[model samples]
Target: MRNVKVIVQGGPANEEVRTLPAHKKNPEVGDKKTVFSSHLLMEQADAESFGDNEEITAMDWGNAFVRNKKTNPATGKIESLDLELHLEGDFKKTSKKVHWLSAPTDAHPLIPVVLIDYDYLINKKKIEDGDDFTACLNPVTEYRVNALADANVEHLKRFDIIQFERKGFYICQGTKDAEGRMEFGFIPE
Candidate 1:
């Protein structure tokens, strides 16, 4: 038989969809995905050792954009974007970054704000206001209570998920309820 020539080609491998603990039931399909957009608040601080040497020179607060994708919309989809929350203007004079949580409750909306301090840095970090940073918002569902409980127990690190009738990615930050129930303050993105 006559000799035949063959060729091989390489291309980007297709990645399998990852399932987060939240979205384990009814996964989002096709173009049906949650798109979140919101204005975020950020702060910046100074870099120094202990003593009076530590001081904030600038402060800034501005709006930012946060985005994330939902591979499976069944269990729960938390925010997975890693964007620096920048603080400029008056904020720089005080601390680093701060995040707030907003959510609706039986009585009213739960809004809790927290101040984020820069404990340490690597390679002289650089950030600015009006700069966009990605953040995760937890989705609101029946599982929220359990999730928050786990979070309070330290079983979960951060509660970054958002759930609204139309909105997406939101986080929960604040104290527990009278029954030791954890409430979420969703930062819309």
Candidate 2:
């Protein structure tokens, strides 16, 4: 049970909103989670930024409900509300430092990326050009590039969530994809 406050400016913006309860639990497998939320304050100029064929990046704000709150019919009492929290944008343009992969060669330039997942965190050495990586719907809160390389995987297993600095908060999906890749998602905060 954590509390989060969010504010957005320079776009379809809103005044500061406060005291929202973040109570939703992370969603399980096969769940269609709402990964992004916020009051979209799109101005004509902002809308126009998305020119016919180009991709435009923008910061978005919204609340994330990890799980839905439901009441027990028999007890006539509210059981638990789904985990929810405030989320702010963490995309490359809005982030203070953009994340990129160093070129395989020492002299080549680096390449920028929009999303990264657990596989990148666990096995940075094995990532190849065609490897598919996936992240949780929620953003991660904290992470280090070589966490597993330095620590015991079993010891870190107890925590359900991890914060990826400059990335976002992530919750483990506890499942693997068709290619046996670990799947996780982020909830921006």
Candidate 3:
């Protein structure tokens, strides 16, 4: 079997679908075999807890929320619904798509890649007539994460642009360095 590095981008912050817990055990999630399953990549413990529970219904790609369950005075729920919630299952239905790269092996080796992300240089969205531009400057604007890219990245030279699926487009910084590190700068969408 080919070892693929599945990068799950957008999803609810709930622990059920977290990579730390869920994808750790089953790495083949979102693959062709179980791409359309409602409970794709759900943690074993959480799936067991929800055994036959009627309050919460697992929707596409293991996302779940309480619909109409009534329990006494009940605690409040913070409803944070992302517009991209349906991005996981049924390729025909989801707007966003998940990207995967081949894992490194003797036969099919992958390149070591660094993805650089950036936030706005300014903290304020709009500058009014008398707004102080210096004060509104954002202190932290750059973020970087290490990733493994498919072997095809080796052909990319400096300034080559490539889209990282749901992550957005990125420009190649340069060829692999002395440490075999290929860097890409994220271009804001």
Candidate 4:
């Protein structure tokens, strides 16, 4: 052969989908690609958990609650939900920028009321009116606040594969297995 010219060029290879663990904080979660099926660079991510090269794994989503202080028109009373629950272990990861959620400095405020009664409350789960939920650092956006008026941000029965597209990151909430536990995802996107 006299001569031949070839070119090999590309960015890092993307990973394929895989079954992530139900528990987010599982210590055995080694490398991300070692577990996660997808690893796209999150636009508002604080830092990739694995590293600049490795994508974060064991991601989760939840319907975080916010109790906006407001006076009830009918009663002219300020009835407040009085219980807050922060999952120390299950809240596997953290981030600084949550586009969907509104930070304190954001222009808008959270919905005046809990648009959808938490899944626990609807099932007669006995959530008291005076229940206090974790204070939302990133308040739910005005659009989300309004949308929630009709849209029920229901709970995912169990941990399932979450995906993202041009629209946004989506949590697939149809996991058949259930431990009968109710928890909210508080991390940022």
Kindly list the per-residue Cα lDDT of model 2 for residues 75-104, writing each as its tens digit.
544433322232443334321221111112
TM-scores of the candidates are 0.18, 0.22, 0.46, 0.19
- Which candidate leads the pack in TM-score? 3
Which scores greater on lDDT, model 3 or model 4? 3
Query: How does candidate 1 score on lDDT?
Result: 0.28
Using lDDT, give the best candidate's number. Answer: 3
- Weakest lDDT window of 10 consecutive positions for candidate 2: 146-155
**lDDT of all predictions, in order shown?**
0.28, 0.30, 0.47, 0.25
Model 3, 75-119: lDDT tens per residue? 332211111223333444422232333223454565678888889
| Tens-digit per-residue lDDT, 55-118, candidate 4 | 1222232211222223358954433311122223233343221212111112222222111111
Off by over 4 Å in 1: 1-154, 162-167
Candidate 3 Cα lDDT to native: 0.47
Off by over 4 Å in 2: 1-96, 101-159
Model 3, position 9, has a per-residue lDDT of: 27
lDDT of 2: 0.30
lDDT for predicted candidate 4 compared with the true structure: 0.25
RMSD (Cα, Å) of candidate 1? 24.6
For residues 50-159, write the lDDT of model 1, one tens digit per residue.
12322222111232222222222573322222223223335435443332221123332323322221222222244456543332222332233222111112222356
